[model samples]
Target: MNIKYSLIKKEEDIDILQGKESTFANLHYKYNKETIQFLKTHFYRQDSLYLVATDENNAFVALCSLDSDWWEPHHFFLREIFIMPSYQGQGIGKVLFEKCIDHANQFQAKAIVTETAFENIPMQKLCEKMGFTRWDNPQWKEGITYKLFL
Candidate 1:
């Protein structure tokens, strides 16, 4: 399937990129008013970046959210990465991830970091494949931090 990727530039873009149904229900959050508000607050921040991948029909297939790390100006924290169920195994996630890496590089970020729940084996594997090393004693319980140096 033909796919297009781009940075989310406006609130309307978020509405288009996120649908009512989600493949990541296990993550336990929806694009509701509160979430949308949160996104709106940070979406255009100078230190934040949000990207989306869409199919030919303009439906969202994947998304990635990132922000500058508070403790390290050269580091970026990957806040979210999700791929629709039907798009899994099609390398859409990898493409979205590569976009994040490229964005980091363009901003002169030295590293990218993210955390995933222990039960999310697929995400763990993806991070590993993307060359992210697991950090020890992550502050978030039941999850591990992954870091990829640029």
Candidate 2:
């Protein structure tokens, strides 16, 4: 698989959010034109990283986004990440994850954090495999939260 990473442009991002395979269905709100405009305004400010994995045919096989904020000037909150269903189990997710980790290192973040639904076993397994420790707590949102010190 010859997957290449490219930044998500305005039009492409809108198309993605509206695609049939969108993952945003889990969220309460929908990504519409207004939201797309808002995202464009501050997307780069939050250090948003959107990478599309395209095959040799030049078609997008998968896509992932990493958005983080400097909560403590040295800590990062990894807000989102997702890979398209068609390319789910081909190691593309892992590669994209590594790229995000590498960028996090460059930013000098003391720690990286992410949250996943309790029912999302596959993501939990992947996080564990990538060295993320489950930070279990009674008050934590009813699902597993993983953190890694980079």
Candidate 3:
């Protein structure tokens, strides 16, 4: 299937949170009961990348967003990356992830950081594959923090 990736501007914080699909319902397992780790969010940052992927028929295939870390301007926080379960394991997530990395690079960010539960093996493996190292964050203890120094 052909996928079109694009950048979108947000007028409201909620606009970026749109597009929840039933196709992703099956993904709500133990580690992701009500929503995925990334879905527990508020898209309020103005300095951010709102990237979206749509299939040939203009359906939401995936979403990946990144923003400047509020506490550390030099670090880019990977706000979220959600792919439809049907499209998982096909490298689409990696592409969106690479785009976020590229955006961070363009902004001369020192590193990129993200959080994922230990049970989310796929995300951990993806972070590892993308050169993110496990980081011990004193601020957050609920999830694993991965950091990739640029």
Candidate 4:
């Protein structure tokens, strides 16, 4: 299936927040109301990217976000990455993540950072497969923190 990727602009693509329901490894997932509001208020801004992918049918299928880090000025943060369950295991997520790395590199990011639930094997595998090293971030232990130095 053909897929299109777009870099969302401020004040645009808010409807993506009304994303589809999905599940992975027994975890129920969706762009919930609180997530939508938070994204609109904190993520829809300059110097950040909200990449959304749609299929030939024009239905949203995947998404990944990258933003320059405020805490680590030279690094970029991989806010989130997700592929619709129907679209998983098809390499779309990897391609989308590669695009995000390119986006971060465009800004000369020294590294990229992301985190995932410990039970999320797919995410952890993806991070490791992408050359990310599991970091011992004392500040967070509920999950795994990954760092990819560019």
Q: Please, what is the TM-score per model? A: 0.84, 0.75, 0.80, 0.90
Candidate 3: give the clashing pairs.
none
- Weakest 10 consecutive residues of candidate 3 by summed lDDT: 22-31
Q: Which ten residues in a row have the lowest lDDT in candidate 2?
A: 20-29
What local lDDT does model 1 show for residue 69?
Answer: 46
Candidate 3 residue runs with Cα over 4 Å from true position: 11-46
Evaluate model 4: give its TM-score: 0.90
What is the TM-score ranking, best to worst?
A: 4, 1, 3, 2
- Per-candidate Cα RMSD to the true structure, in Å, reads 2.4, 3.9, 4.4, 1.7
Question: Best lDDT goes to which candidate?
Answer: 4
Q: Using TM-score, give the best candidate's number.
A: 4
Kindly list the per-residue Cα lDDT of model 1 for residues 64-89, writing each as its tens digit: 78888446569988887777778888
**Which model, 2 or 4, shows the larger TM-score?**
4
1 versus 3: better TM-score goes to: 1
Q: Scored by CA lDDT, what does every candidate get?
A: 0.77, 0.67, 0.75, 0.80
CA error at residue 29 for candidate 1, angstroms: 5.4
Ordered from best to worst lDDT, the candidate numbers read 4, 1, 3, 2
Check candidate 2 and list the clashing pairs: none
Clashes of 3: 0
lDDT per residue, candidate 3, 20-104, as tens digits? Answer: 5423223343223334434334345655887878899987677777888546669998977778778888899889889999988
**lDDT of each residue in 1-150, candidate 4, tens digit only:** 798988766544745756567676776677876776665664644668788889998888887788774477788888878788889888887887799788888888899989888878888888888899998877789989999998
